[model samples]
Target: MQPIGTTLKQIRQAKGFTQKDVYGDIISRSFAIRLESGQHDLTAGKLFLILDRLGVSANEFRFIQNDYQATASELARSQIMLAYDQQNFPRISHLATRYAHSDNPAERQMAVLANVLIMAFDRREMVATPAMAQLWQQLTLTKTWTLQEIDFGPIILVLTVQKKQPLAATIRKYHLACERYVSAEADPFHVMDARAAFDLVALQLLLNHQQYATAQQFKSQLLAGETAHFTSDGNLDQQLSLWIWEGYFGDPTVAANRAEALRQIPSTRFKLGIDTLLSTWNKRAAAYHQRQK
Candidate 1:
């Protein structure tokens, strides 16, 4: 908080504005001086008004206030990724332990996500734990979506299937997420990738449940956002998989182009040929939809 005050003072001085110009009638100049000197606090509404006057968003203020450090949410994500890469289950377990008790709802949700990923890596059967159930309720009951909440589509679907849970809440979550992705918070390319991954995962889930109508809707979504560009093998594989699904729920002609799309990637790390892998996916995709007949 002190840092925020000091940083605001620095920015105020650098911007060549006298305190009165910025605070003008928001508060007395003497109080504003105290606010800048780290001797006082302002309500959130006041802080935002002051920041707007200072030509900064709250996000920018945080970056500057933290001396350009990653926000807690970003830091938590990094820790989970690094620990997962090292197969450091204990590290993640500790993270879950710590974050589970955090007063922040986001931290609690992340703890559930961490535990779920750990279960996945250990090849343990995924189940909707109490934490996950609570998370599902939170997401479902929320009036609006944040980028993180929107990103929960995949995990929520995974647990919903495992628990043979009601689809109403889970499907609603996915739909809200679908709508939110149009304004995704990440970089354009990565947002598309993330959106693809979410849609593909949801599409497969609906297909596996033989919910062809829902599957087709997601198929339409993937098509609208589809691209030939990819930056990694994972992206290529994701695209290939979408095309296979395309054959089943979309234009067969469009799906057949996956073979040519395969040529875009030089090779894969897998021993099985990429074409063979895709051929198998195409067959499976066809067979799953054939159940509709």
Candidate 2:
């Protein structure tokens, strides 16, 4: 994980393009230096042009970040699946507890997924004792349920009930409700709300069968709403949800839009989260390009 500045500097040098060659007349030399050093934030359009001039493909710019995120997500998913397969309630419980204390976004996502599984198979009653309830209370109080975070909830639920009759039915019904909510609402409270609902359902569908194309269609519908105008607080969630979708779908344009939306929002937390996501995508794109070479 090279700092973004170091990565930019290396790419620039590798391309044999002097700062004057790329930044000449368009931007001051000092400013260009600052940009490469990560001292100044670049606008979406500006960043694109800079990368273009540097001869770095979008995929190359994003690959490492995406690879990191994918690894974390897969690791979390694998752990949950392992616990489920072994019927290791205690291990699951341990993971869930560890998850509660973790600040890493990736690990937190895994914890949420595990809890969903625990809820579905073991029954909420299984983990609903006073101890778990206290943990749940803490989670709720943190107000940390972002769109990416919520994706794991339904996944855990779906996986837990895969072999159970009544529980599976219940999980399906909940997923259907979420899907219907996305399809029926003309204007959701926030775009992220709709996207979150859509992702939850789509993820469940994918889990049931390897239906990538269908899931992608559902994803397109989510993307179509990105152009809708939104206020800072009013649609931040929607935009964030869309950011997650764009990240997974490999759409740089959507990622740009998400970055712009985050800039518009006033909250530090929102900005930080969006920035991390954008950086991840940019690096992911870079990684993808590198693989092609």
Candidate 3:
């Protein structure tokens, strides 16, 4: 997609309108230049007025709006991951705006919620920005069902402290939400749907927080010796879970075990970045313990 500036310029030229022509009476020529350069914010009313003057239809504007939203959502997701890895919760909070402007409301909502959950898990001062608060309220009221949401509450709470503890109140809320759907005894399809929601949340909580021992325990409880069965089915969830375990618990023998397991899966079916992820974890884990020494 063309950059906003290019799109604006094209729309203007197609109409044979200069910046001055479009905003000559409303906004100063300097302001129009800033807007075109992506240096100034244009309110919806002002933007519509400019489009009207430029003879751009509402339909055309809708396409540009969607493009802008998509771009913002992608950028927001990248920024959030970067901030989380760097442990910069403040910056993660700041990047929430990029998501707020997204055209895909679902992605936008997930971005903001994910950021807040990350902050809460890191035990950072929860600065619930107005946008974050609004999105939270909307999700709660709408009762939107998503695996992302299901996984978020427990994952965040688990990371809040260094020890195993009771699930936080927020985590319990989501657990109850999951139970409500499961209780309906809906189709097998729905049962799998509920399982996906719960499983992903559990997997993420265990993996991200480096609770490999606890994760292994949970795996046994939940899967009941079906770990190999799940892994054989090329389940991404199972793969991720095992990867975390081997990465954290494995000695040289364990690494060999994991490598063998990876080999059994169809190479084309499973893109096991497990080797690379484990290698990185090994380095970091060594450095972490070294620093403690």
Sorting all predicted structures by TM-score, with the top scorer first, yields 1, 3, 2
Candidate 3, backbone clash total:
1
Write down the lDDT of every candidate, Cα atoms only. 0.67, 0.54, 0.53
RMSD of each: 6.2, 18.8, 13.6
Tens-digit lDDT string for candidate 1 (102-194): 887767777887887677544467766788887767655776766765555556666676677765456555555545544433343244455
Mark the regions of model 3 whose C-alpha exceeds 4 Å error after superposition: 1-99, 103-107, 113-128, 135-216, 221-234, 246-255, 263-276, 282-293
**Best-matching candidate per TM-score:** 1
Worst 10 residues of 1 by lDDT: 181-190
